[model samples]
Target: MRREFKLPDVGEGLTEAEIVRWLVKPGDQVKVKQNVVEIETAKSIVELPIPWDGVVAALMADEGQTVDVGLPIIAVDTAEPGVPAGGAAGTAVGTAAGAAPGEAIKALADDMVPRPPAEGAVEPGAHGSPAPKEERQAVLVGYGVKTGATKRRPRKAPAPPAAAPAAPAIPAAPVANPSRVEVTAHPVPARVAVLAKPPVRKLAKDLGVDLAAVTGTGPEGSITREDVRAAAEIVAQPEPRPARVAAPAGAEERVPVKGVRRMTAQAMVGSAFTAPHVTEFLQVDVTETMNAVARLRAMPDFADVKVSPLLLVARAVVTAARRHPMINSSWDEEAQEIVVKHYVNLGIAAATPRGLVVPNVKNAHELSLPELARSLGELAETARAGRTQPAEMAGGTITITNVGVFGVDAGTPILNPGEAAILAFGQVRDMPWVVGGELAVRKVTTLALSFDHRIVDGELGSLFLRDVGAMLEDPLRMLAWS
Candidate 1:
């Protein structure tokens, strides 16, 4: 028997996904719950696992192809090794021996054709007693199965392939360039295959690095991300050029908008226009907070985790939000009401290769300082690797964008959709200030708070900003407020 596997809705009400890569190919045997393909949805990259044990008969879709939620993407043959597809009773050899040429070929093809599994029998070993059809299947990370009809965007026709160049004749003498000599003296090296993992290959493709030209340093001569980055750096160097140069045709490259970048663009545009933004700025002397971070880093509790100024800033935000509940809230236009949240899902904006993603720590106000630091570190690492789940980015009550990491001072930030406020932390610098009528050098930083004017008035916004600044100015204030 042959079974066709349709793409399930991998949560977040997504209609379609792009096939990033296929882990298995035709003729490869795959077991139940084994990941067979990696797909990129609007939110993040997800791996889809096969639900049955079978040999891969065919891949219905190509890598990089956009497939709808209910479309079949792969076919698997579930019959025993010696038995013909469809069953022994409808064996292709038996039917061919007695039927006409056309009829025999049609019979064999029919036997090999894939059929969708019965309703409620999507999982392996579930045919005996089918589960409820509406029940969710845990096939993809952070998502469940949702069956629905979706329209697939028409794919553009591929451009015609360019003609291959003629092979170069081998040189009889040694070449001047050592790299060219190896190519001319020996042809075997040229034919050597480029070895790299799927993720490494994806990195090389994104960086526009030619893997054939890169020398791999990994075990067994496989390329690594560091190698790709090094090659990209070398390729990025500028060469000497004439002062005046003629413009060339088609100098620009067009990148298709999709995935995380597409979703981020849409969300940002909606937030900027829908929310009436009011920004407030404050300068604070954070010398005490800086010293506290250093002391925390040396303490046993924080020895294993990273301690930075951002940690204290995050703590201050959470503490201030508690003091002023209205600051951590949202505007409900439909209900014409203000919704103030009791718990804080503190969002930390992180810039990743894909784009800007804010994965917050759930219930941050309830966590200890050390726990918050650990969560923040893990969140950063996960975002950098492009593994943050959609759930982690949802339900954020307030956000903090640390522009300081980029060596930026400060700027008015747009509020995250559904959230009432966002805080921007700037780079800290040493500045001369007057304390007790005496001028002294102090560690100073700027904070920009942008809030929904409709939800928080000017006075309330100012008070919230003042409280956060005070907490940072004196770390002891956080304890008193708590």
Candidate 2:
């Protein structure tokens, strides 16, 4: 019996995904829970596993194709005809092989199709509300029974292929239709098959490295961006050719804004326009916090952990939010109310090659000093690795963007969408400061707080910012304030 597998909704509010690669092609045998495809959504890459054991029949989607959720992407032949449809083997097959061929096929599809979750099924959202039909139905395949609509969902217009390096525009050839001239240029270059992750691929492309020529140095002989850059330095530079003509100035290059970049653009535009932003800046002496960070690093509890000033800043923000709950809140325009969160989902804005992604530590207000340090370490590692899950990026109440990592002093940052406030941490530098009414060299850093005017007034925002700054200045105030 043949069964079709629809593209599953792997994340909340995911509408479509770009098919990155196919692990199994037509004519391959597949096992239960075997990964069949690698897909890129707006946020991250996911490996989707097929739930049933079968012989691959057809690949419904092509690599690089953007497919809508709930659309069939592959068909499989279960091909077991001797067993009863309702028996254990039949259940595993998703339909009875004993039934007539046509009947079995239809029955298998009917039983295998993803369906809306029935009552009492766990939904896939932060609030535990029932997810959309697409999300709920995806879970049906995890179990033996199937539950979605048999018909494939309508697909959007096919996405154009990724943009490539452009050749210089040439003069058009004369055509029969005098109004229309056909311009001919260089043929499109073939894409090289490389085993690097999406972020590494983006890095290599930005560095203008040919992945096929670069040697792999990562685990399992995978190509790393470092290797690509090293290869580019050795081979990418070319001597000037007398016959080569340089392209004209101001010739625009096309870049496809998809995946993380696309999503980030949309989000930033929405947040900038929707929120009435008010930014406040504060400069504080963080020498005490730096000393505390060094102390923690030498401690037995933190000996194995990576400790940084960002952890101290994060903990300070959480402590300040606890004192001023309004800072950790969202504007519920639909409900026409200001929602204050008692707990903090502290978002740390991380910049990646793909774009800016903010993955938060859940219940950060509840974590101990060492636990927060560990969480911050893990969060940064996962984010840089491009393995941050959708759930980790969701439900952030407040955020901290450490622009200091990039040697930036301070900048007014846009608030993360749905959140009321975002704090930007500037680089710590040695500057002359007034301590005990005497000017002395001290470690100083600036903090810029941007908040939604509707949620946080001038006085409340100032108080919150001051509290965080005070904690960093003294480090002991973090404990007192907590």
Candidate 3:
């Protein structure tokens, strides 16, 4: 029986997902709960499993195609024998020419079964018939086929000529057998089997590199995407550009904004216009905070955890929020009230390949220093890997963006859609400063706090920034304030 698998909502109530790659192809056998395709939803990249075991009959959607939820993406033949396939329940029903539309699909399943070649049968060729490509089984959950030496049914070699008692001087007329004639006239080229992922194979094809000629550097001698690209660089010549060429008038490239970029743009625009933003800037000597980060790194408890200046900043924000609860709040326009959250869900803005995503730690104010460090590390890693679940991005009371990573000083960061404020951490640099009424060099960094004026007034915003700045200026003050 042929079964069609529709795209399921992986989570987050996603309405659609882009087909990143198809791990199974037509004629390939697949099992129940096998990851047959990888899809990119609005939240993350997910591998979708096939529910029924069968041979893949067709792929309804191509890679990079956006498919809606409940739409069929792959068709699998599940019937072993006897039972008939029908059109209902996602099964494909087919019929011969001049047959009814509801006719049972029996021919498809039968054709899928392999058969032996008859005696004196003509081998598949360009002039005779198209050659049958070898089909290999694939793994349960990955971009590779089943790993092992491929075994193919051997073809019977031509029989040796028998010695006759009487020898004839003239040569006998050719038997004119189609297989022998075609094989002798146009010899078939030997096929080289190479182990490579589908994406790597596509890359090799695009680069015009023969996978068989390129040595693989991956596990089990498998070819990787980098191997294909490197081989392409060595073999493919760069196309020379035409001097002084002009583009056609009114020519422009158009890109469809649909995924994370689209979501980010929408949120930024909404927050920028909807909220009356008040930005407060402060320059603080973070020399003490940097030293504290170094100390934390040396601590036995933080031996396995990654401690950074951001961790100190996050800890400071959480500590300061406890002092000024209004800073950790949202403007409820519908309710005509400011909702101040008692527990801080501190959002750390992370820039990923998809776009800007803020996955927060739940009840950050309650977590210990080490626990907070671990949460921050896990959140960043998950966001970078494009695996941050939708739930991790919700219920953020306040956010902090570390623009310092890009050597940026500071900027007025827009509030995350529902949050009341966002803090931008600038690059810490050695700058001349007055210490004890004398000139001295210190690690100084600028902080920009942008908050929703409707929720947090200037007095509240400044005090919050001052408190955060003070924590960074004197790392010991966090313990004192806490």
Candidate 4:
């Protein structure tokens, strides 16, 4: 018995996923719930598990190929060990035990000889096959007679034209024993496997470039797109110009957008166009907030977690959102109303190798200061490692993008889709400030808040920004507000 495990919807309503790698190869025995493959969807990378215990028969999809949900990616055979499927072993054993010598020899010859297909027969995936390549039926291994299909071989040169008619050749004498047979052995030419990804291979095929002849410049000598394109250009030239210099490897490159980067691009474009954005900036003296962070770091409660200015900044935002709930709400166009969220799923935008992923802390408004700091630390660590899940990114009511880490002053950031407001925290530095009518150097930072004008008007946006700045300027304000 054989069973197929299709690619399931690992993420919420994901339609497709790219196979990143195969953990289990053909002939490997796998148990139920054992991870077999890792795949990357639009949101994140996830590992998939097999559903039944069996030996892997085949890998239906190639790595780097994006497969649709519910399509079988692997086949597993459930038959017992040492027993071939379809009673092939039983037949072979029975033939060797009771069959006559001639009959047994005949059976062995039939198995060894390559037989041509019947007239009008078409091989799978060949022209005039019963079904198209995408809809072809999958066959189990070791179940029936083998097909004549084989791996691709180099094309042979055309034979010379036939000569004019001549005298008939004499026949050779037959062997003394009729059952005796003589077979000639032919050496097969070894083919070197091309080292190129699926996309690069496709590009070479489309450009009519032979990968075997082209030199690979990619890591580990894998062929890249630029190498294929260069080969194609060389072939396209009418004549080789020895004086012509070849272009540098890094002169041009193309990257395919597919995973998290693609999703971020689409979301940013949609949010930028759909939401009418209104930004407000305010420069605040955060000397007191810096002092408070230093104090919290020494305390026993905060000894285990990291204490940074961003932690206080997150706390301030939560406090301000509680005062002005409208800033944390989203505008529902279909409902034609402002949807205010009572709980804040505060999102922190982290720049990862993949892209900008905003994995938020759920119910941030309800967490204490120390709990919020720990959550922020965990979220940052998870995003940096590229392990943030899809669910962790969803349901964000408000977001804070800490541009301060990059040593930037401020930025008018676009809002995350479905969220009404996004706050930008700038770098803190010692600047001239007028405290009690005296100019003195103090730690100051800028805060830029961009919100949807449809729900949060100018007054509400300003109030929210001012409240957050005030809480940061005087950390005691958070105690009073709470």
C-alpha lDDT score of every prediction, in listed order: 0.80, 0.79, 0.77, 0.80
- Candidate 1 RMSD computed on C-alpha atoms after optimal superposition onto the true structure: 19.6
Would you list the rank order by lDDT, best first?
1, 4, 2, 3
Q: What tens digits encode model 3's per-residue C-alpha lDDT throughout 1-482?
A: 66556666665445568888889887899988898998877766778788888898777776887764554567678865534544333333333211321122222222222222322223433223213433334333222222233344556665665864543333256565634532223446655446665557776886799988899886546777779988887786567545966678778666777667777887899899999999999999999999999989999999988999999999999999999999998888898988889999999999998888888999999999999999999999999998887788889999999999999999989999999999999999999999999999999999999999988899999999999999999989999999
Model 3 spans with C-alpha error above 4 angstroms: 11-13, 29-32, 79-83, 86-255
Q: Once model 4 is optimally superposed onto the true structure by TM-score, how far is the C-alpha of residue 147 displaced, in angstroms?
A: 30
Put down candidate 2 lDDT per residue, 308-426, tens digits, no spaces: 99999999999999999999999999999999999999999999877889999999989998899899999999888887877899899999999998999999999999999999999
Count the clashes in each prediction. Answer: 0, 6, 1, 0
How well does model 3 score by local distance difference test? 0.77
Across 1-482, the per-residue lDDT of candidate 4 in tens digits comes to 56556667777656568988999997999998899998988998888788778898767677888765555567677764555444875454345323442243334333432333323334333433222112112233212122243444344545665975654433367556645555444556534445664457777997899998988886546677889989999899958767857679899777889889998998999999999999999999999999999999999999889999999999999999999989989988997988999999999999998888999999998899889989999999999988898999999999999999999999999999999999999999999999999999999999999999988899999999999999999999998997
The TM-score obtained by model 3 is 0.64
Cα lDDT tens digits, model 1, 87-193, are: 76435444443454234333443233222233333223322332223312235532324332333444454566597575676778867875554433433332335
- Residue ranges of candidate 1 with Cα displaced over 4 Å: 79-250
Lowest lDDT sum, 10 consecutive residues, model 3, at 96-105
RMSD of each: 19.6, 16.9, 21.2, 16.7
Error at 169, model 4, angstroms:
76
